[model samples]
Target: MPARRKDPAIPAGLKIMAPEPAVRLAKEAEIGGLGLDWSEQPEMLDDVGLAEWERLAGVFAHDATRFREGERAAITAYCSWWSAFATAAADVRDRGPVVEGRSDMDRGRLVKNPATVAMREASQQLRYWARELGLTTDARVRIGLADQGDDKNDDDNPFA
Candidate 1:
């Protein structure tokens, strides 16, 4: 059996009040409330938080008419939740290596998926924000994408 999912460490409140699931929780926490006291609970938000959901709703609101056209992916709304569990590290500089590693991992797994690229982009933006805010060090930003299992090579593809 798969390992039990870990419970989100975020506190009971401070989450967005919306029920929508598309908003990226980390983005919300980072940019939603200014100077929000998130020193506790690992400083991460859940994908289900109301505030994040509202943001997701707003993104869709840009083209509300497209829903009937089947323009959105079933998982698009939930993908942003992946970042909600991100911890507000005690020191941004200290976590730089980890963030870099996570970025590379996300990029490696982002093959053939536009959403993955968006997520990777969002992660990079967040890192820059952290640096600009003086919340962490900039030294750990990774410059190269690591080869993930999906790397396509002429030798492996029968069609190639």
Candidate 2:
């Protein structure tokens, strides 16, 4: 089990109004609202991404059936990294695929920022944890997730 958040932003009415699963996450993650809304408002976590983000968050937040210890910390790290992802993505989104910045060695010279690299790295972190926690759609399917069982063949999937 993980320690409670030091400063939980507990939301109003979620305890009574949210759906059963979301209510569980709110309590387990000790988050405000249904643990469904984003703090940074990243486009990556909006639209279809919102549903995916919420689902992934539920796995990290729920308490009754944790895969192992330190889950809450992992959840917090995941969200923090996602915020980083969003911020970096925002730069890329606004400036197009490439942007110009001054080189570290020489401020006078122009250099390409290529925010996509940072965006990709942040996205990779999110994806890595999702796979680690079995939160991805493909991961869920491979582990017989609909029936809700651990991936018994995890050892057999040599590539994994």
Candidate 3:
């Protein structure tokens, strides 16, 4: 059997439990940023992508430094996937999951709508990009961006 792929190493800045030695090593190994501006939207993006980009930018505004130029491509991909998913989802909603087949043999029969496939593919891609960009709640927690809920005092509460 093939070996499982290892998880990507978390950046020192995003690691909540790194030892001092590991943190120092990670800092030394970190590459310098290209200093690209995050505010500028890529011209290739359509209106839907642009809106998603803006929404994500606003979401990360408080910790903008965490996303350097190295992450721009990931952010762009996430936005693009979001746009695709949204469009596909809308199409599926309007057309329903099944539609008349356009192929020769299946012409008169009902088949799964193309939009349903698109939506599934887009959602999968979106999930991948979301994890890469730390956009999901679980991703945020994994990267030490979200509160881990460890601060609650279980000893003091009867619910514990």
Clashing residue pairs found in predicted model 3: none
Give all TM-scores, in the order shown. 0.22, 0.46, 0.70
| Highest TM-score scorer | 3
Best by lDDT: 3
Cα deviation at 127, candidate 3, in Å, is 0.8
Model 1 segments beyond 4 Å from truth?
A: 1-36, 39-111, 139-160
Error of 2 at 23 (Å): 25
Better of 2 and 3 by TM-score: 3
By TM-score, the better pick of 1 and 3 is: 3
lDDT tens digits, residue span 1-160, model 2: 9986644577644554566875666576654332333233334344445554565546545434444333544554565667678778888778777455556775665555567888888889989776666667787677666534654667777787
Candidate 2 residue 130 Cα shift, in angstroms, is 0.8
Question: Which pairs clash in the backbone of model 1?
Answer: 16-50, 16-51, 17-50, 17-51, 18-50, 93-136, 93-137
Residues 107-144, candidate 1: write the lDDT tens digits. 54323433444446656765554343222333223423
| lDDT at residue 100 of model 2 (Cα atoms) | 52
Query: In angstroms, how far off is 110's CA in candidate 3?
Result: 1.0
Q: What range of 10 consecutive residues in model 2 has the weakest lDDT sum?
A: 32-41
